[model samples]
Target: MQLPDGLDVGLYPIEGFTNPEEQPEGNGFFITSRYARNGITFGDKYNRAKADSIQAQFSSLYYGNYELDVSSEEKTPVDFSAYKERVADSINFVIEVARKYEERDLKLLNKPMETKAEFNRKHEYILKDYPNAFVNYDYRGYTVYINSGKRLYHFWGRNAKDSGEKSQTTEMQVRKSEPEVLSLLNRFRPRKLYEVPTEQGFCLPYGFIAGDSGHEPRNIGITYRLQNHPDVTIFFQDLGMKPKAGKEDDLNEKDYVIWLWNWQYQWSAVSKELIKPKWRSIEMDGRKGVGTFVKSVYKDGGLNYGYVAYVQGDRQARNLKPDLLLYVMQDSRQARGNPPMDKDELEKLAEHIVSSIKRR
Candidate 1:
């Protein structure tokens, strides 16, 4: 008798016995069947109701196209007759004794809580009986049992590997949920312009609002980020300032610092076609500087205007560097279709901010 997949039962053929015998205690969820028997009998492992349910389901699969002949005990002959009724009623029947055991196993596998009591009740016996059996944990909310000899195993989940063998256990990390990006943004309230004093030097912005500043100090330098505008990011980094392991022989006296401005307007990449970057030379606080201006029509039918400037410091501070950068970028979309500054006005603002850096 053949059994369906995921039935959680075992089949063993007997050489001379004519009927089936249940041996749940012998090796596995076992069934010993004769080579040529046409029917089977359930063992004490299964109750009458459980056996009947499996029998009805198994019998219902044979109602079409071929005829059943019970006279031959070996195999059911498939004869296409006018009745066209196919049936496995006579071929053979796998004992349904294991079905009752599975009902108990189901309750154990799908228990509400994964507590010590539930695990002890369901798995203590298996572990005790099969000394070589090992339990593999899946931190993604499941467990698998691999028996000895690498021959059999079971999994606990909605999609279980009820009958299978595996070579080894696979390690995995727990899959955790992530926080919403909007919630993180909502936590960032705007702050007034303040002097951001660093170990290198002190710098301040003019009439700008600050948000969360993710800062980290390292051996070589300090790096940080400040939220600005609606979607713009202001990044600051100082190098050749902090003491590290490899700096013992490093005598190069030039320090490097940078300010990167990332403008995230409500515009697609296609807006680049309409907007052009214009670069010009200027001076700030007796230091030379370069300015870049950009303006364009956004994909969302809004206007964007911005300016960026890289100004040279009057004298390189021991902590910071010889250069500084400033950005005054904004879009009509972020300002509710009304911008207070134009391109030239933004360039002046950026230059003024860069020129205001104090090296103390």
Candidate 2:
């Protein structure tokens, strides 16, 4: 009955019911939103709590991320146990989800400025970033369809009532803080296990690899890098796949060596200068593998080293299927002696890791 002054555009009642059942005017409410020539439909049941701020969620307000609710319905009924599990899962996937929304928000909320005249000759795109901390996106923080397994709503709007403003944080990038306010339990989510794509029963060294905070390998298989050491990486590479350099080595038996040589060394920063490989054969639990711990220098005069090995029984064995691998790599920046993990320490780590392998 009232026009939404809180909204930039006027909203009009336009709908009857999404449900086919015969219903009175009190069953549900329907409205449509229009911006210029385009518009979207909005609808909700006539029932919901009176305490929530409805328009402040969708309509633009001042800065600061916050939460608001959208109408949800249950296919069955509200399952309290299921709801708690979903909340628990949020801590793990919140960053992943926020990263996705950040990409979208950067585009939608930060619309580029249309130019008539030259303004520094650079096409300006203002508001390129916003705080991504989950707390800041309290509006639509997380929700589910009534008794439905899950319903992911597109993230929108500013922090509720600007609660995030008082904390007054400049600690992380707008993207980093997108999902703030995780508990201690949230911080220590258990490490995920990644089994080797190879048929071997041994699992990859997933415990050591940090979460996908940085340095994702663009390969088909699992790739992980250390949180502290961007230079250090481990990969369970898909055999025979071409490296980023697009060059592929043909030898089938040399995949472990090639996997290492192809990905990092194949990049341009590495020099054409030579450090001949000195690979050693390692045997474990009735299977034999090859490992190489060697160093290479960058064209920029920096140092890097890699340890990669494969398990296919003997070196010449054409055996396939249950291939196992051990790999380690580090760039000069993280390898520099000024840091805590020097060459000696890295080599020891490589040796210890490679040596510990056993038949699953």
Candidate 3:
């Protein structure tokens, strides 16, 4: 099977079932990277076509799995046979999850998996008591903790009220509040640029222009005058799913507009939580980068949303703020149809555009 452009498949060795002879004929257990929160453990008659390797390969960083010990679960223990039935029932959902993970949008379903730093920061006090404890997986909105030896698994989250023998878990009912609209775009005096940056800031420095002329920098409109900043020039394109009742120049679904904002200054940390659950930190040329999808719905029947992909670096003159930020905002889904570009495609396009930026 052909994988997505940036995705790869790996064959993880399921413990005990590693040997074809030791396996239960066609029956075996498999789990996804999202097994913790999504509660997706699949079991089915193994197909040779799906089995790419017999020795187990660590081919993809986004997914890996090992045999699950379903019988040992003290809380609502489920036998292997029953578990297989459940997997069969949710096969479609499981497949969808796998597809989305491959597209790098798994966080839209559950919160992004906690990085090591994040896990430690939230569980410092608990870890002090059990220094040997380590995180295994975040299942069902709870952090599963395992001992240093990896012999035990415990669930922990916002409330670590439930304690288990050899398993210390936190149990509580918590709901995530929707994030507020960032409102940063509204603050900008917009413009558009089709050509790659030819000078300093976040574009190709002293390089030939690229992309079609239609995409080159141009006036958003005479009405939305470009606001001149003493230190840097800000270019942006308005991203609205639908034009207001009387506003003719407002961007609409058919316009196929991809708003790119290029500005340079000293960089400050951007809070990922403010964007959405789909955001992730990235790195480019040793500089911090961030990317995410944003959607906001208005009670008055208006919608504002898009994908954001940007990178920041200090590669300019010392006196001037060296940080450069390149952002792209695409219109949200419209009543007419899906946006011109989906989150994944929009991010890739933005990354390519930003790649033109260079240091003086």
Q: Candidate 1 has what TM-score?
A: 0.28
RMSD of 1: 29.8
Residue 231 displacement in candidate 1 (angstroms): 9.1
| After superposition, candidate 3 runs with Cα above 4 Å error | 1-279, 284-286, 300-302, 309-321, 331-340
lDDT of 2 by residue, 1-360 (tens): 111122121111111111222332221222121111111112222212211112111121111121112122234434444444543444334433434444555576884443333321111111222222122222223211111122111223322232333232222223343344332113212122332332212122121222332222212233344444445555433222223242233445456355546554424445432234465777544467676666666677776666766655222322232345555556545423445346676666666656665433
TM-score on alpha carbons, each prediction: 0.28, 0.34, 0.22
Q: Compared with the true structure, what per-residue lDDT tens digits does model 3 show for residues 230-264?
A: 11111222211122232223332112112221121
Off by over 4 Å in 2: 1-221, 237-252, 255-266, 272-277, 313-321, 333-340
Q: Kindly provide the TM-score of model 2 when superposed on the true structure, using C-alpha atoms.
A: 0.34
Using TM-score as the measure, the top candidate is 2
Candidate 2 global lDDT = 0.35
Which numbered prediction scores highest in lDDT against the true structure? 2
lDDT of 1 at 298: 58
**Which 10 consecutive positions of candidate 2 have the poorest summed lDDT?**
9-18
